[model samples]
Target: MDVSVIGSGYVGTTVAACFADLGHRVVNIDIDEEVVATLEAGEPPIHEAGLPELVATHAGPDSTGRLRATTDYEALLDTDVTFLCLPTPQHADGSIDLSIMEAGAEQLGATLAETGDWHTVVVKSTVVPGSTADVITPAIEEVSGRTAGTDFGIGMNPEFLREGTAVEDFQIPDKVVLGADDERALADMHTVFDPLVDAADAPVVETDTRTAEMIKYANNGFLAAKVSLINDIGNICKEFDIDAYEVADAIGLDDRIGAKFLRSGLGWGGSCFPKDTNAIIHAATEAGYEPAMLKAAVAVNDRQPERFLGLLDEHVGVADRRVAVLGLAFKPGTDDVRNSRAIPVIEGLQARGAEVVAYDPVAVENMRSHFPDIEYASSAAAALEGAHAALAVTGWDEFAALDAAFDTMATPVVIDGRRIIERREGLTYEGLTW
Candidate 1:
């Protein structure tokens, strides 16, 4: 199959590389000239695990030429299937701002109208329940002057790829959803993913387009709520002077409560959880129903940074002190700092008149955009040395191995948010929730 993916962001780039690797000739379309050039050079614009090597093998001069990128949407006329991978960021009031996705759909519709053959368009970006059938289809139909199911096939196939482990997740996904009302359109989607399903032996979920869209929101919302629930429980355990990990381990033994996303930490933050949960809450409120549990979950997540900061304040006075921050990326293995918990930690430190020095394996450059005046260290050891206190915000593996590094701290105080540090003798260690 000759496939075209629009918008060369994280999801767009990953899917394009993976599709090409799956033995399909794929073309990536993006408006940014620099991003297009980078992809054409067989290099990824984003820092994701295993993406560079995949792009290098499938694209550029040294490889099979199965993958390519372009700045023009007109290239879509030559492809059989197109995936709309545009970003749907949240608005100020929690509703999704669909301006980007709308524009891409209009341009794709015009491109499809120019061609005589039929093409399958899939909404690969996460959206609200009725977005694909209600908003996207109407915008495309108005411009193209063609009916959705008859002239062109439109469907919703949401992506479940995590940031750091996107390649592995896509290759071995537990379930593959193909949402379409028409038989032909659904079959087209199956054809596109047949190779991946066969490789992973994953389950195929057949459903309507609207149901598929809801599945994505429900999936993210449930997981986010679960993390927040655990955080709430962990907070109670902290007050009782009990170890939260031990209790979590005991509960995880039951088959009903599996041990994924069970670690109590600084709460959930990323592009997916915050955006998806807020979008659903906004959508539900518009329909005149208050989502109580989800709202409480968000409340719990928001208060965790303050709780961690308060623990640090109890240990030492942050006013007129130098504090070191460990980890900036939301999680390790990626450089994306969107909705990272480190933002709040740094803000709290600065609010208390503390000098902030931060360090992450790969997220220092990204965090610099948020806090330009703060000092950044090249290594964790450099950030710890000469600091009055250190706060661990991310659970990167390197922080777990810092035994001698804690000895260099002026006050030897460590407040861990993610439980990624080990308690040692001669060090003042405080875990947010043991």
Candidate 2:
């Protein structure tokens, strides 16, 4: 299959590289010249695990010529399938902003007008349930002057790739969804994903485009709610002086309740969870139904950062002290700092007049855009040095190995938001939810 992916952001770049690795010829189309050049040179434009190796092997010089990138929309005319990987950011009211995706669709549709053969356009970006049928399909039709089911095919194939393990997730997916009302569009989508389905032996879900779009939202919504529910439980456990981990362990023994997302701490924050949850909530409200449980989940997630800071307040006053913040990325194995829990944690510390010094293995440069004046340490040891207190916001693996770094702190009051640190002699440690 010859596939072209539009918008070479995190999802676009990873999907293009992984598609090529699955034995398909892939062309990544992006508006950014630097991103296109980086991909052409076999270097990843984003920080994702295992992406560099895949890009190097399939793209650039001295590699199999299965993958390439281009800035021209004309390059997509030759491909059999085009996947829209543009970002659908949220509006002020938490509704999805589809301007980017609509523009990309219009451009793609205009380019397709030059080709006589039928081409399939797949919606790979996460959007509201009715977006594909209501907004995107119409945009493409209006531009190309072609009937959707007749001249060009349209489908919705939402991506389930996580930031940190996108490559692995794509290669070994638990399920593959192919959503389209047109038979030709659905058939073409299955052909494009047949390699992955056979290789991973994953379940194939065939449904309408609307259902497909809702699946992505429902998936994220459920996971977000689960995390918030546990955090809510963890807060109750804290009131009773009970270890949440112990309670989680006992409850996880039942098959009905799995152990995943059971470690409750500062709540869920990342690109997908926050955006998708809010989008669905807003969409549901617009449809004359209010989702109370989802609203409660968001409320709980919003308060977790303050609760984490409140624990630090119990140990010592940070109004005139140096506070070391470990980890800045939303989660480990990626450098994306969008909607990281550390944001509010840092804000809370600053509100209390604490001098913030933060450190993350790969997120310092990304976090710098958020807090330009705060101190960024070169290493975890460097951040802890000469600090009055330390707060662990992200659960990086290296933070668990620190033994003597606390000795350098002036007061040695440690607050663990992720439970990655251990209590020891000569150090006052507080776990957010133990």
Local accuracy of candidate 1 as per-residue lDDT tens digits, 149-222: 89889888989999999999899997998899677788889889999999999999999889999999899999
For candidate 2, lDDT tens digit of each residue in 336-432?
A: 9999999999999999999999999999999999999999999999999999999999999999999898899999999999999988999898888
Deviation (Å) of 94 in candidate 2: 0.4
Candidates in order have lDDT scores of 0.93, 0.94
TM-scores for all candidates?
0.99, 0.99
Worst 10 residues of 1 by lDDT: 109-118
Compute the lDDT for candidate 2. Answer: 0.94
Q: Which 10 successive residues of model 2 have the least lDDT summed?
A: 425-434
How far residue 160's Cα lies from its native spot in candidate 1, in Å, is 0.6
